[model samples]
Target chain A: MRTKNQKIRDFVLSAISVIVLIALWCAVSTSKPDFFPTPMATIERLVKLFEKPIMKVSIWGHIFASLKRVLFAIGASIIIGVGLGLIMGWNKKVRAAIYPIIMTLRPIPPIAWIPLIILLFGVGEFPKVLLVFIGSVFPILLNTISAVSMVDDMYLKVGKVYKANTWQTLHHIVFPASMPTILAGIKIAISSGWMVVVAAEMLASKSGLGFLITRGRDSYDVALIMVAMILIGIVGAALSIVFSFIERRLCGWMSS
Target chain B: MASKDIKVQVNHLTKKFGDLLVLDDISFNINKGEFVCIVGPTGCGKTTFLNLLTRLIEPTSGEILIDGKPADPHVHNISFVFQEPSAFPWLTAQQNIEYGLKIKKKSSEEIKSQVDKIIGLLGLEKFRNAYPHEMSVSMEQRVVIGRAFALNPDLLLMDEPYGQMDIKMRYYLEDEVIRLWKATGSTVLFITHNLEEAVYLAERVLILSNKPAKIKAEKKVDLPRPRSVSDDKFVEIRKDITDMIKWW
Candidate 1:
């Protein structure tokens, strides 16, 4: 059904877009030769990383350490954020009481909490976990609240007329109806959370991609620094792709 | 749970929207198996009455009774088909119809049989797996009606269920509803602004006054079964009701 000319046009457009992007990256990266590496150099560093041995502690060690932190942090975010969001959305009293505190806290950036988190939890996994949780939880919570609030009142009435108890109604009506927005919030949380992990780990963790970047900078090893940067982009892309696949499979019903 | 004559008694049902009264001390009795239509002008509290019946909103100063028993939403077999095609967009037509059955804890086989019967009866076999977004407005309305009827409720409340449809589709759905009503014998209290639809569908039509609405008139259509709009008597009654709605 697709026209040959249209496909050719699309291909050319994609190729041009990539060429322009690479050219722009080359321009920016090459401007400061001592401080920045070229696109080709970064690719070379990435290829070198692949040739290295895989183990619990190698170049991949930092990757694993960062991944662990991100996963745990995201898990905590989902539990606390989604639970509170649902409560705030479902109950007016809960929303009124908790919303002011959340608003007061939300304006402060996640990185700003590093000092306080380190102060309370000490410079360990707890601080990093807390930072990621703080970074990711609000988006999920706020989105869930709005999503649940926006659900058509008719569905709830339908639930009531069917004599659905509180738990059943929440499961059958509110959750499913609010899923699309919740998923969107999770998506935003995830990408932002990944970005935060690197920054958090750079500041604190001794064995993470961010730590690797810091180590590279301290040693003045530009190749390793570029490798870490490349890795961050790759990991972010991979997370989005994986989450999107799961979302599509689970929520195909919602689109129709 | 016994199959006996049940009367839905509304006693001094007064409703207000802040300072503006919507239903002014309205009262009525809907007999078991009777189909009554409440016809009124815009903002005449017809919807408020239906909402009160389903307890979507509590009456400002009254209670609804089923026979001698007080109205209980948890125990009452009451279902609604709204003016908007209110089928859950995520669920297929079949699933929407099966929703009430599932919630009521019907056996799978029973649910299957009932769903199949309703789908076949409503000529919705081809569209059973289609979600609400994939359907035309009329098709979505059919799904809504089928879902309501699947429960086999003791009383069915419809709030302008056909007002959104085109004229041809409305007539077709109206006929379908009448057929279903005859087959199931459920008591129906329909709220509509359309005088023609009220006359065509109901055994008795209750007319309400404008704004601070109250029951202005009630007319029993003793016309024969499968009433025709083209019939002279049907036209006469329709005209009278139209004038009442237009003026009052």
Candidate 2:
């Protein structure tokens, strides 16, 4: 009962906060017309963006391009990272051999690998996707390794007493026990992958939301830049909402 | 006892954790289809004793035999209920009960029938689909107990499975365990610190000394089924065991 009331209060508070933010933006824009674009001007620019191509494509086309790169990168990262992580976590020999390399690579920012990735794959779709993959894979892999390695010994003992083979134990016990942590890792990976894709596009892409921002800056169209920024924010927020919903569904056991 | 009737035999079982000795030269025998409870003082290495018997921890020196052969989990069907709640959080009550049978590669139809029987016997029909986190502590323990009994294991080892529950719930689950044991006819080795629980549940109660635990006394209770705590024999047996292990 209390939670229902709290939920309503939380929703009302969030809505009021957004309204206040937009009102502040509008007030600031009125005072400095040339420097800051008003909320109306940004919304108008966003609508006009759909009518005409900003960089050889419509707004949705740019969004789809960015979305495609991020989704592919994240998908590949989850598959490869989770597989390698489980192996590394389960086997001492593999963990000793591979964990050092991962630790050394993980600290370096993904943007720092942009030049090398471009040289290796060329300035096409591969480089952008690779950068996003590099950005996302480490977090997912590290979290999976920890999750699998730190599984409660009690659960393993349960498996042992049940006469479960190693494969059965892994599939039935370890995998399910680590799922909540793995889902958390996936959430982190998606946002990180999204950010890397934008940075990669800003540096080299001919079409994408990042490219739209760059084009707007080159033309000194502040409203257009604001529009792109707003779209990026909205898309990022939407992705997060989708991931949270998935987490709640899949890991409901963790919470309740 | 006849060799064929001895389901479990622990010969000079000892366990040492590095420099620290936990179980000291413990030897016991459990007959086929017997309900035995091991009672000791708090932290008297009861869990270590169960773990050694279940082969979760290797014995420093000794042998655990089941049916005249070395006890191997791979060859024998052994189920354990830990002191803590051991239900899988991801699975519902019914699914947890099916876990052991599934591991044994039983047919799907057989698994369903066994699960249905255990769930019904445990009176978990209403909370059949509830996950571990969604259920109360007693219910979670019931799921764990149901999971262990579903396999009809050769030996069922329980380590204070109801230590965290209230007296009412503990007595209720203890009765349920007795019902399951009678119905399934599996050999049971239950370890707990509660003397009343031992007298109430076991045909034979093994008492242990504190620390480096060794069997101090063994009392046989020939009382009839559904013995009450207030009964003369039950109270006498509970008092005798309680006095045997009295530290304070």
Each candidate's number of clashing pairs is 0, 0
DockQ of each: 0.52, 0.75
Computed on alpha carbons, the lDDT of every model, listed in order, comes to 0.85, 0.90
Regions more than 4 Å wrong, model 1: A1-11, A24-35, A53-61, A254-256, B1-6, B16-21, B60-62, B243-246
**Residue B118 lDDT in model 2?**
94
Cα lDDT tens digits, model 1, A96-138, are: 9999999999989999998888888888998897888888998
* lDDT for predicted candidate 2 compared with the true structure: 0.90
Docking level for model 2: medium
TM-score of chain A of 2: 0.95
Candidate 2: tens digits of C-alpha lDDT, residues B1-248: 78899999999998899999998999999999999998887877887887777887889999999998999988888899998999999998898999999989999999999999998899889998888988888989999999999999899999889999999998899999999999899999998878889999999999889889898989998999898999998999888887877773
Per-chain TM-score, chain A, candidate 1: 0.89
